[model samples]
Target: MIQRIQSVFLALGAITSFGLFGTDAAETEVPVAGSEVFADAQYDVYDSLILTGGVLAAGLLLLIAIFLFTNRKLQVVLCNVALMITLAYAVYGGVLWYTDSAAAQAQVDFGALLPVLTMLFAALAARYVRKDEKLVRSADRLR
Candidate 1:
């Protein structure tokens, strides 16, 4: 059961979540007061404790879910919870970018997409876990 497809998906999700620490979610150009130069500011998950903690928690949840393959129901629930956490952090990052008045222009980076990928992987894993549960229930009924 540990070798199932859902476990693979959960692992991928965890990897992507952990990958956030090394990538910049967004880049902004801030004009310096009394100067013609614009300063480049990059924001990543590590920039805020809330973001950093949320990402780390999400990654840990995915990793824990992988080992819970024997409990398909709980694994699915964990995947969904992790998905929610990832979404929250993604939105939080977007809000930070949007609320920064000093930012003249913002560019989305690969780090911004990692949370989306993690969510996708989590959803896929949950779907497969549900499928496995259904198959098991049906097989039991056949006995």
Candidate 2:
């Protein structure tokens, strides 16, 4: 269970994705009643439904895949799906920054790539899952 390397990878993925909440892609000042308040780019996550959904989905998939260890192939597939979602999330943020102009007053932060770490972990977990599946198949053949 917890001893499995794949499980560890999946857990790390979940942690990193959720941890995005604590890290700011970028920081800016918000004015309220003539007072300036510091804020993080994370506020953008709530503004963009697609980005929010992708982040939540990617974390959820990694967590859910952990329990499906018995179904190694399916677990691998789910991790891959999570990987794709994370990739899209990162690219969407990148594109947003690239296309944005100074007139738009939007902050550009490569820190959005934080989710990419989760994607990397998911990919690693998928590789391990596939390895486990192959091992099982080989064992079955010998039996």
Candidate 3:
């Protein structure tokens, strides 16, 4: 059960990393000089990557929460890591939001929300795992 949980976590981590770091030729475009509308094409790409990563992380964390009882220890530790990562991502998104225009804030908000949700789910999963662990230990003592 622990091995399976680790595999799933590793798979999620791989997919999220690829989505965050992979460059898509289809998504890139050349910007014309003095074109105010498309001045920050690269930044847009970066934002898209961040948003994708956040969504993937959130989805994975929710899945982990749903399966928290399968491997309590591993899931709890993974949840802790996910919580920290999401918090960091949220901080980065906040900084971006403050530095950019309203349109960029929209993008930042989209990215920020996912990490926040991910953290929430991870925290919940950790709580469930810890509770279950305690219950199991108490049951063993009574045996």
Candidate 4:
């Protein structure tokens, strides 16, 4: 089952989520009161309780879905859930950028796109899962 195409995609999705956990989510640059130089403040997702929980849950869900080879329907549902979690993470990141920009300098780093990649992988995995389910059904009708 681990050799399945969907499993590979799920693995990739999990890996990307782990990257989200390790990398810098965003950065802000603000000048000191009397200095011409600006200092960068980096935000890591793991530092926030909510973000950390959401990201870890997405990755774990992928892993759980991978083992549900016997239940294609459940696997598809879990993958979709994981996809939503990643999408929510990206939306929250945008909200932070929008809200933070008004008060001070805020720059969204490229790492913010990691959740997008995770979503793509999850979507691909779910597609393959659905294909497999359909194939199984068609074959059952023949026998």
**By descending lDDT, how would the candidates be arranged?**
1, 4, 2, 3
Clashing pairs in 3: none
Q: For residues 1-143, could you state the per-residue lDDT of candidate 2 as single tens digits? A: 55699999999998888776666564444422321112232334553577778888988999999999888888999999999998988787656544543213444455466787898899999999988888889999998
lDDT of each: 0.85, 0.74, 0.50, 0.79
Q: Would you estimate the TM-scores of all the predictions?
A: 0.89, 0.80, 0.55, 0.84
Task: Give the Cα error of residue 82 in candidate 1, in Å.
Answer: 0.3
The TM-score that candidate 3 achieves is: 0.55
Clash pairs detected, candidate 4: none
TM-score for candidate 2, residues paired by index: 0.80
Off by over 4 Å in 3: 1-48, 61-68, 101-114
- Report the C-alpha displacement of residue 31, candidate 2, in angstroms: 6.6
- Evaluated at residue 68, the lDDT of candidate 4 is 92
**Most TM-score-accurate candidate:** 1
Of candidates 4 and 2, the better by lDDT: 4
Q: What TM-score, to 2 decimals, does candidate 1 have? A: 0.89
Better of 1 and 3 by lDDT: 1
